[model samples]
Target: MQQNAPFELLSQLRSEAIALAAQGLTYSTQSAGTKNIAYVVNGVNFYCEATDVKEVSVCENLMIVPQTKAWMRGLVNSKGVLYSVTDLSLFAGYGRAIQAKKGHLLLLAEEAVQSSILVNRVIGFRYFNESDEMSSLDDKQEALDGLSAFVDKGYRADGQDWYRLNVSKLLASEQFREVQ
Candidate 1:
């Protein structure tokens, strides 16, 4: 046996544990660059910072609240916690999301405000570097003109334009505050 072998093993184990914790906080399908969770709402692809996401699951048994805005999908109980779910597609001026047999919800990270965003599907995690960001939207994509205010940046990958949404800004918006 080598001297100080036990101490060295413990040190290695500690380092590995820390790395694992960080990976949990920063989710990604790719190994390099900033991490994001890709999701689709009404055929539009969007990415949210991985750190801002708490969970993604198929939401069922939604309890619709009367006299609320059209975009409000109502309350859903997940893991004994009640979350106010919003139809992001309708909120963004798009038509209502297709209410199928099942629906997906992206839960926001625990913070001052708690809510879930109704999405068509969770498209898995994505990775993008600073260099991957595009300077502006394409000429034909005029409908996305106002989206710049809610996004951190825009990127093109896998033949699709992905907008990195700023969740914090979305949460802080007056429109969001008036959801009640």
Candidate 2:
């Protein structure tokens, strides 16, 4: 079902999935029912709501990104001004959803200067059915704070279902705040 990867990759992924499933999955809600985005990496599936995403682009040489207290991935030249990039996958606690290759950057607008998140391969966009029920994070909500919600059903690339990603909590995490 995959191509050109070591056997250990899948094995490790299996363990990783189990670990992830044991913990709480984060998500949010949207109008017209609920929506989420499916991002694929090394044959693995990662889901997030479409609203969480900002601008998508190919990876380019970043300019003067200060390598200080910030979780600055690098200083990328977006349009003209140097845009400080945030590596969300790192914060999400998973292998890169998208490698920092020639073409991959998801710029999300956070108040003013957009926040950049690196994904593996952004499969595409997806929406949820109204019939889907919500599942609040409860204790998990404390860590996520006022931004994240909970979801029971979301679309996976392989036609299976999963929980949506919580973009609000993600942006609010220590990993994001460090971006300067």
Q: Estimate each model's TM-score.
A: 0.76, 0.54
Q: Evaluate residue 55 in candidate 1 and report its C-alpha lDDT on the 0 to 100 scale.
A: 90
How far residue 2's Cα lies from its native spot in candidate 1, in Å, is 36
lDDT (C-alpha, whole model) for all candidates: 0.78, 0.55
Model 2 per-residue lDDT tens digits across residues 61-151: 8553554533356767778655566554444444343346743667765646556766567767666655543453453443322223422
Model 1 score (lDDT): 0.78
State which candidate has the highest TM-score.
1
Model 1, which residues run further than 4 Å from truth? 1-30, 138-141, 145-148
Considering only N, C-alpha and C atoms within 3 Å, which residue pairs clash in candidate 2?
Answer: 58-103, 58-104, 59-104, 63-75, 97-119, 97-120, 98-119, 98-120
What TM-score should be assigned to candidate 1? 0.76
Candidate 2's error at 166, in angstroms? 2.2
Residue 14's lDDT in candidate 1: 79
Best by lDDT: 1
